[model samples]
Target: MAARWLKVLAAAPLMLSALTAAQPAQALVPYVAVPAERNLEGAGLGIAQAAARLLRIGQADDAARLAALTVQLIPDDPRGWVLLAEAQLRSNQNEEAAVSLAKARELDPKNAGILFAQGSLALKDSRPSEAADLIREGLKLDGNNAGAYFDLGNAYILMGKSGDALGAFERASKLRSDFWEAINNQALVLYEQNKAGEAIKRWRRVVGIKDAAEPNLALAAALNVAQPGNTESLQRAAKALAEDPNYVLESWQKEQLWGPRLRSAAAQLLAQPALKADVERAQANAGASDDLGDG
Candidate 1:
C-alpha cells in the first residue's frame, strides 16, 4: 500500500497556486511531468538495466520482479544482486531486500552503492549508529553521491543531530537543486532545532518550487502558526487540501517523515475550522489520483 502511494505521489501533476499577474509577491510555479513509457521488457539489455529504468519511472513492483529474475539469469553479477535489493527496498520488501544486500556484500564487499543501501536498511531498522557508520564509509568510496548524502541526513536526524543533518541536507541540495526531498528534510531539521522562522522560509520555498503534499502542508501549517486565522494562509491551506485531500481525510500520520513536531503543526492546522471544512470538501470531491489515504 505504501509502495502504491509512492507511485501515485511520483506521477501526480504539480498543483501550484492559482496566481494572477498582479500578485508580484507570488512565486512562479514549477511544473513537472513524468513521461509515461512502460516499453522496457527485459529485451536486449541486461535485466539489471531494465529494472533500473523501470524503477526510475515509478514501477517498483515491476522492477522488483525483473530484478528477481535478473539474479537467476546472471547469478555471478553483483550488479544484479544490488539492483534486486534496491527494487525490493522500493517495494517495501525489507527482508527480501536484506537477503539481496547480503548476497551482494558477499560478492563485492566494498561496493559503495550496496553499502549505502545497507545503511538505509539499517536506518529503517532503527540502528542509526550502524547506519551512520556504514554511510560514512560509503561516502569515503563515493563522495559525489547526492542520494547517499540525503540518506546520511536521515541517519543524522534519527540520531538527534539536527545540525549534522542540516549540513548533509545542504550538501545534497548543493549537489542537486531539484532535490526537493533534501530541501524538505532541511526544513524539518530547522523545525527540530526550534528555528521556526527559518523553517517556514524553507517550507515556503519548497511550496513555491513544487506542489507535493508534505511541503505544501508544511507551508500551510507554518503559515497558520506564524499568523493564526490569517485568511490568505487559510486559503493556501485550503489549496493544499484541494491538491491532495487524502492526507487529511485518512488522518494519515507520516510521523516517520514529518516527526512529532511537524505532525503537531499539521494537526493544529487541520484543527482550524476554515481549513478543516475546506479539506473535508476536497475529500468528498477528490478522485483516487488526488488522494493519499493512510499510506
Candidate 2:
C-alpha cells in the first residue's frame, strides 16, 4: 500500500507536464495546416510538366491544355508561361504564344529563360531577322544569356553568314561550358560554310546531349565529306534520313533559313576539298616564285 501511494503521487506531476507540452503543440496545429494547404495549391505542376513533354513530342492539343492549366495553377512562375508558349507553338498557335511570352517577358524581362522561348518561336516563324533583334535586347538585359547568344547564332545562319554565327555560338559555349544548344548550332554553321571537318569536331563536343537530331545529321554529312569514303558517310546519311524522312543536307539554310527562293547549298562540304587543294597549290606556286625571286 505504501509503494502504490508513492506511484500515484509520481503520476500526478508527470501528467501535468504532458498537458503543458500538449498546449504548445495544439497552438501550432493551425500553423502546420496552413503550409500543408499551400503546398497542395500548386501541386498540379507535375502533371502539367508531364503533359507538356508529351505535347513537345507532338501531342499538340493535349499539351496546350496542360500548359494552360499550369498557368492557372501557378501564374507567377515565369516557367509556366514558357511551358504554355512552347505548347502553343507546337499547336501552330504562334501569334498567341508570342503574345503570352511578351507578357512573360514584361513580368520577367531580365530572365534568359523567357528569352529562349521567345526566340525559338521567332526562329520557327521564319523571322530570324526579328529573332536576332529579340535576343539582342535580351543580351542588353543580361549579358550571360546563353539562350540569346544561341538565337543570335541562328539568326546569322538564316542570314547566310556562318562566320558571325560561329562567333556568337562560341561566346555562348564559353559563357556556359555545358551549353549543348550553342555547340550543336555551331556545328551547323560550320557545315554550312563547307568546313565539314570543323563541323564534325564541333558536333563531337555535344555528343551526349538529348534531342540532337540535326547535329546527328550534320555529323554524318561532315563525316561523309571528311574523305571520299563511302560506307560510313552513307550509313550516317541513311540514319539521318530515317530520323527525318524529309531531311535535306542544306535544306534549312537554303529554304527556311535564308531567302525566299531557297538557294542551292546542298552539302556545302563537297567544294571544301577542291577549295583546300586550290589554296595549297596556290601556296606552293607562291613559294616557288619566292625561291626564284630570292635566287
Candidate 3:
C-alpha cells in the first residue's frame, strides 16, 4: 500500500502540468481610437482661394471645377456659392451660374453685391427690364456702387429709356470721377439723341482720360462727321483701327452696344477713300470680310 501511494504522488505533478496546458486561453478585446475632427470650413476657404487664383490666371474651367468642390465642402457659406457662380460665369455656364447665384441669394438675401451680380446676369440673358429692376434694388441697398450704376445705364439703354440711361451714366461718373466707361456711354447716348456737339465733347474727355480704342474710334468718327474730310480725323481713325482691329467690324461694334447713330457715323467715316487701306488692314487683322457692312 505504501509503494503504490509514492508512485501516485510522483505522477501528480505531471498530471497537474497536463491539465494547465489543456485549458483554453482568454481572447483580448481590441482598443479602438477615434479620429481627429476636421476643420472643413477652413479647408473650403483654402480651396476657394486656390480657385480664385486659377481664375486670375485665366484657367476658368479648372477654377470652376475647384469652386464646385469648395461649395460642396461648405454648402452653408454664401461666399463659396458666389465664388462658384463667378467661376461658372467665366466658363460661360450661365444657367449654372444663375443657380449658384440663386443659392447665394437664398443664403444672404440682403447682399447688394449678390443682387448686382444677378442683375448683370439678367442683362447677359437679355432680360433688360429685370436687370434694371434688380440693379435699382441693389442701388437702394448700396447706393455708391459706380459699376452698378453703369450696368443700370446699360439696362435702361436696352429698354429704350435714353433719358434714364443718361441719368444713370451721369450718376455713375459722378460717383466715380475716373469711370471712363460710364462717360463713354453718356457720349453714346448723346450721339443717339442728335447732340453731336455734346457727344464730341464727352468723347474728347474720354480720350483724354484713357487712350482706349472705343473712345478713340468714337472721337474719330464724330470728328469726321462734324468736319468732313478732316485729315486729323482720318489720322485718328487709322491709329484707332491699328490699336483694336475689331472696331472695323460692324458686328463687333454692335456687340459693344454701339447705337445705330454711332454705327452709321462710323460706317460713313470708314467709307472715306483716305481710310480704304487702313480699313482693309484692320479687317484683315480682325479676320473679317473686306466689305464693312452696316449690320
Candidate 4:
C-alpha cells in the first residue's frame, strides 16, 4: 500500500495537470487510484520529518511551508498540526500558530504538549490567568516537564502570586537540577517576598552553576544592598555589565521578570560612584544596540 501511494504521490502533479486539461465530460468521470489512508498518513509523517529537519537547520520559513503541506495531506493528524504550529511560532506568526495549536488540540485532546504550547502562547499574549490554567491542565496530564513548570512559574509571577511562583520554580529546578534559569527565578520571587538572604543564596548558587549575566548582576545587587561598597560585589557587577550591557537597562530587567525590589537593588548597584566607568560603558553599549535595532 505504501509503495502504491509513493508512486501515485510522485505522479500526482502530472496527474493533476492532466486532469485539469482533460475535456469537461472526461474530467467528470470517476478516477480509481485513490491513495490508501494508511499510505497518506505515512507520507505525511515522512514530510513532517523533513520539515522538522528544516526547522532545526534555521530554515523556519521553509519548515513552515512544508509543515503547511503536511497538514493539508493529513488534516486529521495532530502531530502534523503541532509541527505546523511550531513552525508558525518560529516564524512569529502567533495568531496562525494559535489556530494550528487549536486544531491539533481538537484532533488529540489528550496531548499535553499541545496544551503547553497553547499556554505558552497565552503567556506571550499577556493573559497570565489563562496561561496558568492551561499550563496546570497540561501538567495534570504530564507533570514531568521542567520547562512547563518554568513557564507556569512565570505566569504565576505575572499574576502577582509570588508564593505560587516560587513553588513552581522550585519544582522546575528540582526536576532538572541544572536548570539555572528556574533557580534564578526562585530567587526573584524570594527577594520580592522580603527573603533577601535566601534570594542571595540562590543567586550565588545560580552563578556557581552558570556564570551568566543575569544571576551575576542579581547577586551583585543583593550583595551591594546587604553590604555597602563591597569590593567583590562591585567587581562582579562591573564584569556582568561588560558581559551583557542590556542588564544595565531597567526595561530589559523588567522584561526578564525581575521584580521591583530586585530592580531597585540593581539600580543602586549601578549608581555606585566606584563603578562609574563600567556603568557608562554599559549604557553606551545598550544605547548603540538600541540604535542599531531601530535602523
What are the per-residue Cα lDDT tens digits for candidate 4 across 106-152? 99999999999999999999999999999999999999999999999
Runs in model 1 deviating more than 4 A are 1-66, 249-256, 281-295
Location of the lowest summed lDDT over 10 successive residues in candidate 1: 11-20
RMSD of each: 17.9, 19.3, 19.3, 4.8
Candidate 2 lDDT over residue span 221-241, tens digit each: 566554543565555544544
Which pairs clash in model 4?
Answer: none
Q: Compared with the true structure, what per-residue lDDT tens digits does model 1 show for residues 132-202?
A: 99999999999989998999998898788888999999999899988888898999888867788899888
Candidate 4 segments exceeding 4 Å error: 1-25, 28-39, 287-295
Per candidate, the number of residue pairs that clash is: 0, 0, 0, 0
Q: Candidate 4: global Cα-lDDT?
A: 0.89
| Best by the TM-score measure | 4
Shift of residue 134 alpha carbon in model 1, Å: 1.7
lDDT score, candidate 3? 0.86
**Reference-based lDDT, residue 200, model 3:** 89
Name model 2 segments beyond 4 Å from true. 1-60, 66-83, 175-181, 194-196, 204-213, 223-226, 248-295
| TM-score (C-alpha, index-matched) for candidate 2 | 0.56
Sort the candidates on TM-score, descending order: 4, 3, 1, 2
lDDT per residue for candidate 3 within 1-295, as digits (tens), equals 3354345345534533543464444422234222122455665677788789888987788778778877866789999999999999988899999999999999999999999999999999999999999999999999999999999999999999999999999999999999999999999999999999999899889988998889988888988888977987898898999988999989988877899989988999999999999999998888443234312
Name the 10 consecutive residues with the lowest summed lDDT in model 4: 1-10
